[model samples]
Target: MKTLYETSLKESLAIQKRVIGALLMREIITRYGRNNLGFLWLFVEPLMLTLLIVFLWKFLRADRISSLNIVAFILTGYPMAMMWRNASNRAIGAISANVSLLYHRNVRVLDTIISRTLLEVAGATIAQIAIMAVLIAIRWVDVPNDIFYMLLAWLLMALFAFGLGLIICSIAFKFDAFGKIWSTLSFILLPLSGAFFFVSSLPIQAQKYVLWIPMIHGTEMFRHGYFGSSVITMENPWYLLLCDLVLLFVGLAMVAGFSKGVEAR
Candidate 1:
């Protein structure tokens, strides 16, 4: 009986892997189209945006926002911020848009959300790496001082984005109005994410309040990893981790409940 149970579990896992792969391919084709840049757009799109931002900053001759490398600073910060925003935004109508897929016994609503979120996160990550490599090659930026910590912060940022995506996607599925509401909220979240400034640069009183934002911590940590002691930032990895856990728990619960309702219909 135990052997049979194990076999069934393995089969289920294999089937989920296949489902996710197929969905990813379908998403690429649908979103990017079959011709003209194709999958290259995944990285190129964000790369173009980042380059534009970097150019604007340089053109303005904006004095160092902090004691960090300007090119490296924006490169790390903006891409991470964009990743979270894009992931959550893409997840908004994921389940609703793919409702037909749920008719299959193996395809679940959560799978749709996961596949979409993964695509956004993967695209943003690749773009970030590509941009950084070019900047380093051109001597515009130096290699990260602590690559591992930089990666850990990035992972946390992705986790926060995925959790938020699950929550937003579930809520949007339940209420049409949520889509509009979240659109406005995403704008509000932009400056608050600490993508353009260091948390330590804020007034002491404001610093306390800003620390409440989880994305701020992730960005600060990423900067800290790259800039080392050259810049000061307020980052608490433990707090960020705790918030991510809570968000994930609530998000998954909401999504699972919503999925059951969709299945019943």
Candidate 2:
């Protein structure tokens, strides 16, 4: 016979899964209506952006600037950065966008943010995989040297992105103006994420400072997995993991506090 606590835990898990599933479907429809291509745009949007960047870089003689394979470099770094950026960006207005749904007993603030973050992360992941596969088939990019390491980096970045979304969403909820400008701020900071350049490419002094930013570690780790011994990289996965834990702790606390004050409009 199951204890009351066990029964409650199972019921709660079931409810949360059902709520998240429904929210995921709602987001797909809301963001991309029943029009042409609809949900396909989820990945297609990021894939197009990545391809454009690749084209421009190749056109601009990026290959001349680095010994590394420019296509693989861009493919590895850009999409990982996009996963976190897009996830955090999408999480900004999640609660307000779905406040009506919160009227339901099972739906809560965290669920709303999680749903949006999951959508954005999934889109970025699919886009990254699709592009990598096509490029590999065309012989434009070599197969990764350490696929498991790359997967680990990708998973850590996803968790980092989700934690970041929670914190930023909580902040934006309090200061509405911050929400409006976060996109611009994040764009300006994108280059510092080590997506466009490798840590080894930077000066010795700059590398130390750059490592302080957690996103760069994820990017560097990912590139290390792809490029292998072909390049030098400085990525400490443990540091990124510590940062993730701290962010998740702070972000969840802030959300729990602020969420109580939130009222359906």
- Candidate with the greatest TM-score versus the true structure: 2
Candidate with best lDDT: 2
RMSD of each: 2.3, 1.8
The list of candidate 1 runs beyond 4 A from truth reads 35-49, 64-67, 263-265
Q: Write the per-residue lDDT of candidate 2 for residues 1-265, one digit (tens) a residue.
A: 9999999999999999999999999998888776758667655765676678778877987768766776787788878887888898999989989998878878899999999999988888887888889889999899999999999999999999999999999999999999979999988878889988889888898889999999999999999899898888999999999999999999999999999877766
Question: What are the per-residue Cα lDDT tens digits for candidate 1 across 1-265?
Answer: 5798899999999999999998898888888775758667766766676677768877887656534466787777878998999899999978766788888888888899999999999988888888788878999899898999999999998999999999998888888899889988997898899998888778998999999999999999999899898888889999999989998999999988867778523
Instruction: Give lDDT per model, in order.
Output: 0.86, 0.88
In candidate 2, residue 197 scores what lDDT?
86
Which window of ten consecutive residues has the lowest lDDT sum in model 1? 62-71
Residue pairs with backbone overlap in model 2: none
Task: Please give the distance, in angstroms, between residue 166's alpha carbon in candidate 2 and its true position after superposition.
Answer: 0.7
Q: Tell me which residue pairs clash in candidate 1.
A: none
